[model samples]
Target chain A: MRDTIARCETTAHAEGLAAGLTQALAAARDGFSPPGRVAALPADRVPPGAAAVRNRLAEREGIGCFVWPGREAERPHHVRPGHETERPHHDGASDDTTTEFAVLLGAVRLGATRRLLEHAVTHLSGRTVGGEPTLRKQLVLGTVADVMTGVEAARHALLTGASVPDAVADTHERLTELDWETTKLLGASGYLADGPARTAHVSRLLADCWVAAPGGTP
Target chain B: MTELDAPLRELRGMCREAARDLRTRALAVDADPADVERHLDSPTLTLIRVASTPKRFRADGSVDDGGYSGSCLARVIAGVELARGDAGLICANTGPSLAGVAVDALGSEAQQEAFYDAIADGRTWTFFGMTEPDRGSDATAMETRLEAAPDPADGMLLTGAKRYVGNASRGRIGVVFARTGRTALSVRGAVVRIPAAGYEATPLDMIGLRGARICAIDLNGVRVPREDVLGAHLPASRRGLWGIGRTFNVMRTQIASMALGVALAARDLVREERPGWSGHERVSARLDAALALLHDAAVQVDHDPDARRPPSVAKLHITDLAVRTTRWAAHALGPGAMLEHPLLEKWCRDVAAFEFMDGTSNIQRLHITHDVATRATAPRPSAGRVTTPTADRVTAPQGAA
Candidate 1:
């Protein structure tokens, strides 16, 4: 975790760290406050050090990050000390079981969602699996989907002080490339089998999801 | 009385009333084919009758409010607009109506007024007898000649055949252009209106635009009165290239507008039938795209009719789009649309016909290339010397005489 923090130097990097920090803080029961004075901190702050490396990473990747708490009243900084961060205590054995159940359930949900999306995209494209055309389609859809997945994963990874901005940006670049590829394919298809509609729908879904993902908004 | 004030005002009111009545009838007969045809055909005849009289007066040497502001011009334009509103009607009456207008434009003032009064009274359909059997695009190469005799009593004798002479069979007056001299340098345009007995009109069968009755006219020694000559009663100047250019510009834009109307009708048909198809999603998107392109082209020509190259380009683009879009709609609608229904098949034929009408797509391309190349190589005029008028010829009709 300290190694991850040592790599980040920007606000996006810090917010990435904050996301991981959130999970860690939740685990540790220690109230987590981002370093630096709250009032003076930029809206999107990364941790100190690795400035040159972080800038290079941002350029290479397409990630950008901005903090968007649900409401000003419920902001992390505004939470009351004793009243906030409360969870019902459980017996040790029950707590462990609950954690295991949560992990397994999350894995299953993610796997199912990925499979459904893959099936839908393949059906829409009318390309055979393992063929050159299908392979190309898969590459485009996978690259975009993976970038979105990475952004989501980075939020939790930030608990361990990972550079969330770099991860989010890299995913964004891949997503943009995927969008271009999809539109070109659809245009070339001469709109066979409702290709334009499918292309438009997927583009809109990806754009919306990208904006909503942690450290992914431009 | 002023030439057209009362008559034109009356014509305007009648046209508006007729147009309104037709629109109501069209909507009421939306699903009834026979009723729609009846409603469309009647108003069309009325308009044609109104338009045809002007040409007869022009041929008889009577009306002369020089060219543009003449009562004949207003009546002709109004008739064209009304005819154009319904494709079936335009297909039926345009040739005869245009024949009348053409005579007024190119005929002698005395001939003009005579034809105008005749057409106004519904006595005759005037024929514009310019096009020859062999000379179509190249009018100067016309073999038909008029020979003048040295003897004063002999007068000028017109010999040779004219083809594509609209309203020739039934017209009382024929405005024929013949080569008074053989050589290209000696080519001259003469407007001669022959009595029906002096000339023979043979109807020519053509594909598409079935309603416009076209005929090949054979003028054999058709003698005209010496005073029947248009514009000072002298031979037309061979160096009048500018007049030809202006005429081409106006005619091409008018044809483009006609093509636009047909394309729009096709689009409406497609929209109506689209929802029932399995490929509705894809078809709708393409339909939207095609409509946008058509609208852009229409607006460009409508806003600047004299922009020259854009009008031809728009005509080509819109006509091509219409052909493809209608073909798609036909495919989507399946066998039902493929049948002799009013919507798809006839419209497809109409669009295809329009593409070849005023100028072929190839000709339009050549014009565009030539215009571009000429502009590029030509010396630039000083800034203040080059002025662009804000008024568009299409929207603001000129009152020139």
Candidate 2:
């Protein structure tokens, strides 16, 4: 789980890692009972008392994410990344199906990109931070990074002709790298470092990513 | 003498005398008839003397040193006089009077004396005609025009309309901004005093602050003398947008102070009338917070009148707080407060006007974001307050102002 989380390149991958870690922590707090132990017991063998105990343990671990020291071994399990991760594939698939997945991925990425640019206009028009102005700016900048990554992954999937699910999965993997770059820039500058220079940067990057995909057509 | 010390001292002495005279008159309203008569007779002239003395004496006074320039002192004196007499209309009439002070600060020495002398002697009420009907936040985008030729008789033909000019209706002089060259972006301002016949002002009936007579001044080929061109001596490349940005800082601070006065007035009234109200505890807490905020803002404003971002933030916070605090006061006071009680409703109205005065909160925030996005680091708190070093502490970014 730690290795998988460490390898996460996109927001979707990071999110999947986070969800898996959450489940593992939950099971560990339930006293490491065998999977079928409770089923083998009498109807009420694993009493509500055990369930409450497990609930408290989970709560404690959740709280630890914020309060635990950096040196603590358990800290990493609870520390959620600021950026979202890409979605993972549920089944193995051949390469030929990947191209079909790219279309769906492209639509979603394009929609997000459009929304982000629209938000920048509203945000820049106003002077205040917390109001409609700040919200718009944040949305625009935040989604630009996310959409750029998704487009890159979609292009790779389209070229490879993987199954729809495999294509999405591959796209998600490519997105993780872009997401890291975006977060780094955001942390360095209080605003999006590149998007402000020009409105077309996001679109151009996405277009290039699509054209570079294995498929002959964008 | 430091550039401003001598003049500041002289101005302080004048203002002290003026304040004392006003206090004396205020206290003697129901006292001895002779005392009241004497107080009434001398108050106007005495206050005017006090206000104008800052300009005349040009010596540093501790209380009012920042605003006391040769002509600014004169306008402050005029404002103090107008304020003391409770003449809202005359006080409102003083917007253009104050604009002359700004002209003195940014304009040339000749321009300064011309506008200042007129304002000081009560010969002219000059409007700083910058804000246009279509261009509220965008002063540089003003559509007004001033075509210049080589003729000394008609130095420049000013043909543009200035809206919401305070003293426009009765102004003897106008410090107007117009597109002097071909470029709409090439806007330049001049101090032009024309015969009343040359320019016409249509009075604008505003909702509140009825005392200030705001008008729309229309200029049709109103000729301006070459000497009247403010900052004309400076190269356009040098003057640039920095002049307007600098002037906005001063204007915003003054406006904030006015709003602060209104807030103080509202808070005082609520405290006096609602000694045992239900939400007195909550109101007290809010008032305490509001006062703290106001004090922080005022200190920053006084320390550095030119720090654009802090004051913009201060103005937005203070005015919004003023409006909210006044509303709370009105609600807590109930029906009695709502009635023709001079304190409650009048203050609410005054503060409301302030909220929209300089630029709306939206406009202020937009400026703040633009500054912040472009700014490498937050500005130091007006170069006065000591900021302790931290790891993430980036040095203050130097802005245009």
Candidate 3:
């Protein structure tokens, strides 16, 4: 688990969020178990590009289930979480979200979140707005620093077991926030439909399905 | 709480009533952006079109609710109500919008008439292009240029590209800011009409607010006549940058109000979908406060046309609040609620549109912080407290040294 997180983070830091998320999505397949929610498993488990992952829900034709390759017998499929096109579960389907899946979702997105932060730093450093490099603005610098602080704290929490019961879910929520703050640095361009912000948005949606409420049962 | 005068209250009520039709068309527009064309005849959209146009240009005559274009307060009242039905659809609707505000500020009698006449068809869309491919919202750094034609009779030629522009592809007539020289004063707005040579627009596939059809435009030597240049009669001081500031101040409040409306819509969706959910009261309370802030900002702008911080602060705070509210609505509806409720998911996407509409939150922060610094640097004369070179203290606690 540590090696996977390390590898994904390293790859993301070296490359970008797309490459990092690609690595993270790959790790999502084998080790995690969703409690009957929209499992955003890659098509045929080939792990498509980050853009493909971001547009996964859009591409789907209202079929909100992913069938794992080897587990077709015991668990035929897992429904997608509270999607706009989601179908109601049968009377017997479970609603309890597993903490293990939330933890894994946190790990998968952690590297990508860091990579997004890196991009923000690089962007803020090179650009100037209103006669100053936005990085020199106290507000912009503060937000970037805050995001970095969150990435470090989340990394630390993942390395050593957290004392909080739902630490992973909390981490996921914080990362989502930090990710948004980082995206803010890109100004209007960041909000583009196909921009890096959508990757974080897709990650948040993925987290929403798997991460249970902080006090909820595992 | 905001205390609205009777006329404003009536305006809000009428807008609220018109919002129902807007809601009906919101989903359809989301499904297919081109669907907006089919609904051009919708009573609500028609009323919006007339309301947005200036008084002299309104071929449809005076609206009973007065009009939304006369004041920032009026725009906020109408904007919030109209946007509650669907902010995305408001962007989808073909009307004067920001361009009208710009013309109202900078255009001469003939220019305004020319501008209004172009969009009188109701079907024709209008666009305002300022953000450049590399410059974003830094209007002063605009690279789009207006250079002298080989023959002066042909006037100047416009060349450069703009990205993230609304109605870029659909607009038949619009305004694009371009620099004729290197200085800030050199930047100018030229009234542009399309189907003209050297103008190309391509719609971008936006993840949300598809109805707005945010697009990229490439202007390769588009023709601009001498009279078509905005602020031609005005001195250089009241030209491009001045109009941009005043226009942005008004648009910011409207954008912020629309964002509040979207948040209200998101919260209401939770109430409708999860009927028994008592967890949304907090959301409702926050929205109420945001409405007040939006109204206050509008009132400030109406009183002081050049006021920047109020509108900037309102936009910066409300845009983030609206986006958060949508997420709150999504979570309140339980897991996969977005799948079960299409409107909620669409609101989630639509709310982000407001942040980039006029000025981004970062730009707003700059205006706000600069205002704060100015206030701090100049201590109030009526205050009684210690003042230092680095800080200003108006009031301190009882035990303060």
Candidate 4:
């Protein structure tokens, strides 16, 4: 009786694996843009067009593909991917996905910067310092430059697609530094507004960007 | 200041005095900042004491034709004045006045008379309970259920829990909204005496607005008589959650006025703390813009009671400004601002509540955006007819002030 039950369980497992593989292969073949569609391959049996497939998965799954490394003694189990992974897939995110996230982060930063700048202009206009638009102009220009640099970095990284370039990595660091400078320039107002008062609205942008970056994403 | 008419000038004078007295009382209170009695006794309640009387309620359940004193504009001025003293105090008193406004808007002649008669002494507190435990900005999606009793003449049985009910525990009268059926659109409203059997109200501890006894109410088969069900004969669209749109046309402006007052208070505090603070062009400009936004909305509301967009825009802008201004003020006073001046932090926390209290800021923007889109897509008037923009078309002043 126990042997029969074990046989039935093994059969069910094999059937389920077959069904999942069939669905995943079909998704990969048709380029599944919707979530929850992922295909797995043995580490030793990686396909020839692995890079292209990884990029496609990153674009569709947002966080990128999974590549589970097999243990020395144990055979790998075929686990299916859901709409969202429990953790960042066991493997790293593609450079393309990182670049995409950087662009999104850049947009959020720019939006927040513009909101504060507009506020500054309105507030300063009525003060004694109202005579000079120089400081405000300079800050605005600096922010615009930061946005442009971020966009350029993202475009380059996306075009490259595979390994993260040194410039792209540096650009992400620079953006984080720029965020610090922004908070300082706006002074305590920016710090409080982004931290406690507005529920970390400005800080959340940076945090989200970090989540999509190299070390954090995987 | 612009030239004011005689009646408006008089009304403003009364409000100014009330505001001055209220501020004086608030400032006199000792280090125990959470003193609810001080807030209750604060002259901010002068607006409520004077405005909640039977004389203010006409025979037909409408406001008396007593010039600006009987108009929403008067309440707007009073709200601004009360808020200047303390936003918490304004929040506490605002609930009672809102209840009065709801009664005037939807109550029958006897209902209004009963409410006014009960509150004639000026100490009686009234409240409105629409938001439930599960509902926030989308209060229309309430879970509080109302069912018909066995006898059609016996009224409905209400069973549900309401959260964030301002003044619920302390107040005698309440305007409560409950879902009548399983459908999303089946929400209805009824007025009831809260201390009645099966009705339980527990005061909630809050981060700010301490003066306001925000409560959680559990209505376990609370009976709501047929006559007390607001707009019962009216269709679903004209009553309960749906009908609040009409009520908000007036209430939004009052809320804007309160927010404006808080912003003004924050501005004054910052300017006083750092004498050189106003020298910053950014600070000055921001204050001016905020004031301009408030004035624009006030003008629109004063001209036409039914004007929608201006009040919402004002409410949205002023609430944001109030929060921003308070935070800015605290930071301007150096690192120990929170410790040195507790009022700044208190005001900041209190003003933050306004964003979610009336309706979330996102909800306000959504309504405004939808209204703008709807108007834009609406067919233009017949050819050869010239139509003026809403801002330009000035009708007879509302509130008869």
TM-score per model over all chains: 0.46, 0.50, 0.84, 0.58
Candidate 4 Cα misplacement greater than 4 A, ranges: A1-218, B1-3, B24-43, B52-54, B57-68, B181-186, B232-237, B280-285, B302-305, B375-401
Greater DockQ among 1 and 3 belongs to 3
Considering just the first chain, candidate 1 attains a TM-score of 0.25
Misplaced by over 4 Å in model 3 are A7-37, A45-97, A130-133, A159-165, A215-218, B62-69, B372-401
Model 1 per-residue lDDT tens digits across residues A1-218? 33332223122123332232223223332222211111111113433421211111122122222222212223221111223235113211123332222222222222223333344455435643333444355444564466447435633443332223333323333333333333322221211213232322222122221211222111
Query: Candidate 4, residues B172-256: lDDT per residue as tens digits?
Result: 8878877887554466667878578889988765545556667778998898887887775565555554456556667777777
DockQ of candidate model 4: 0.02
lDDT of 1 at A172: 30
Residue B348 displacement (Å), model 3: 1.6
Best by lDDT: 3
* Residues A96-167 of candidate 2: C-alpha lDDT, one tens digit per residue: 222332333333333333334334444445433433443355544555546565555455454454345434
Q: For each candidate, what's the DockQ?
A: 0.01, 0.01, 0.25, 0.02
Off by over 4 Å in 2: A1-218, B1-54, B57-90, B93-96, B149-152, B182-185, B235-240, B275-306, B375-401
Judged by whole-model lDDT over C-alpha atoms, candidate 3 comes out at 0.73
Please, what are the lDDT tens digits per residue for candidate 3 over residues B35-109? 678888888888899888877788777455443547888899999998898887888889898788888888999
* TM-score of each candidate's B chain against the true B chain: 0.64, 0.71, 0.91, 0.81
Q: Candidate 3: what's its TM-score on chain B?
A: 0.91
Per-residue lDDT for B17 in model 1? 47
Which 10 consecutive residues of model 2 chain A have the lowest summed lDDT? A34-43
Model 3 chain A worst lDDT run, 10 consecutive residues: A88-97
